[model samples]
Target: MKQWIFLVGAIISEVVATLSLKAGMDNSIFYIVVLIGYVLAFVFLTKALKSGMALGVAYGIWGACGVAMTAFLSHLIFNEPLTSIMVLGIVVIIAGVLMIELGSQAATRKEKGNV
Candidate 1:
């Protein structure tokens, strides 16, 4: 449970860092913040990964969550478009990630039962 929370935090931190990287294009101070955020994010992410989370499942969750949040943040911060196609793509990505997580869990459970 705690690892899940850490995973989410890591994704949020990564998104913030990525967005800040863009916003910091002309400002050294903003760049510094971006660097710090990225470092801290990775630190927590590695901890989560080391805490018994499967690599594929963890990464899928991170990628999907980051992509979705990044898109929303882009729209809110940079006024990027929120077209239907974009929304659809995000939905698809999220669904796929969820399937991967679920599938892996089911496989693990089945393997455990067989043992």
Candidate 2:
């Protein structure tokens, strides 16, 4: 769906922007990427919202994915620590996001008289 695409764009944009922040620390030019990325991220997020994605579900997914991807990429790109405890925390965050998504779906279904 268009909404999902927009949401994914938002997520990827956010991740890139976040990573750029670290890169920006070493070089100021990356700050331009950071600014553009964040701007596009919000734009995509707004599009996703307008396309009928529930705010709770969209935001939850965005935040969780951002955290997970940022952590993994940071480890790969910056040699940042990716310890076991952090991995476990990422898993937990993902699980919680899943629950939020499921709950949102259930609520939508109920509203539609499907339950």
Candidate 3:
């Protein structure tokens, strides 16, 4: 539970950081947010790992969610393009992450059964 919370924080942070990186191109002050966001992202990710979340699952979720949210939000907030192809790519990323998560769960269950 705590690990999932931490992972969510990490994903949000990474997305914020990525978006800030783009916004910072106009106003340098956004760079501060970018730095803080990325740092906190890693910190939360570490907490998630320490809370017994598998690294592959944690990173897969973080990266995929971060990419999805960043792209969507960038389209809304920054007037960036959200073409159909990009949306498809995001969907594929989400599907890949889901598969990774399921595989990790099955592997964990198998290991526990073996033990």
Candidate 4:
């Protein structure tokens, strides 16, 4: 449970950092925010790993969610287009992440003789 919280924080932080990249390009303050966001993201990610979340599962979820959130937020914040094709791509990415998570859970269960 705690690990999941860390993972969530990491994902949100990464998304914020990524989104800030655009604003940071013109503002020094945003650049500092970007740096802090990324650093905190990695710190939380490390905490998640130390808390026993599998690396593959954690990283897959983080990357997928980060990409999806950043894209959606970008559309909102920067007036970027979110075309149907891009939406489809995001869905596919989410699906792939789900598959990875399921696979990780199955592998863990099997190792624990619960499968």
Candidate 5:
């Protein structure tokens, strides 16, 4: 419950940090936000990992979701192109991440059953 929220927060912070990096490219002021956001992002990520979520699943979801969100944000904010192939790739990554999370959970459950 709270762990999921922390995960979500971490992802959002990562996205913000990336955006801030872009913004900081022109002005040094935004670098502060970028640094703070990155630190907070990792802090929340560590907390989420400690909250009993599978490492493989949590990291996979975090990475894939971050990539997807970054791509979408780049399109919206920077007017970056979004081709059909790119969209398909993002979707596939999302699906793969979900599969990894599910598989890890199933494996953990099975391991517990064995013990």
Candidate 6:
């Protein structure tokens, strides 16, 4: 549970960092935010890894969620248009992440001879 918290933090950090990149284009101060956001993101990601979350599972979730969240946030923050196809792609990304998570759990259970 703690590991998941770290992972969530990591994801949020990454998303913020990515958005900060766009903001940084206009103001140099936002560049500082971008750097700090990325650094904190990696720090939390490392903590999640140290806490025993599988790399594949953690990375998959992080990347997929980041992409989805970034898209949504861009739409809200930048007034970017989100087409139906883009929304469908986000749904597919989420489904894939879910599949990865389920597979990871099954693998762990099998390793423990619980399957």
Expressed as tens digits, the lDDT of each residue in 1-115 for candidate 3 is 9999999999988899999999999999999999999999999999999999999899999989988999999999999999999999999999999999999988988989953
Q: Cα miss at 107, model 1 (Å)?
A: 1.2
Cα lDDT of model 4 by residue, 24-53, tens digit: 878868888799999999999999999999
lDDT of each: 0.88, 0.97, 0.94, 0.94, 0.89, 0.94
lDDT computed for candidate 1 = 0.88
Give candidate 3's total backbone clashes: 0
Give stretches of model 3 more than 4 Å off: none
Candidate 3 colliding pairs: none
Please give the lDDT score for candidate 4.
0.94
**In model 5, how large is the Cα lDDT of residue 109?**
78
The TM-score values for the models, in the order shown, are 0.92, 0.98, 0.95, 0.97, 0.92, 0.97
lDDT by residue (2-97, candidate 6, tens digit) is 999999999999999999999888888998889999999999999999999999989989999999999999999989889999999999999998
| TM-score of candidate 3 against the unseen true structure | 0.95
lDDT of 2 by residue, 18-85 (tens): 99999999999999999999999999999999999999899999999999999999999999999999
Q: What is the C-alpha RMSD of each candidate to the true structure, in Å?
A: 1.6, 0.6, 1.5, 0.8, 1.8, 0.7
Top-scoring candidate (TM-score): 2
Model number with the top lDDT: 2
What residue pairs clash in candidate 2, if any at all?
A: none
User: Which residue pairs come into collision in candidate 4?
Assistant: none
Candidate 6's C-alpha runs over 4 A off are none
Model 4 Cα shift for residue 25 (angstroms): 2.3
Residue pairs in candidate 6 whose N, alpha carbon or C atoms collide under 3 angstroms: none
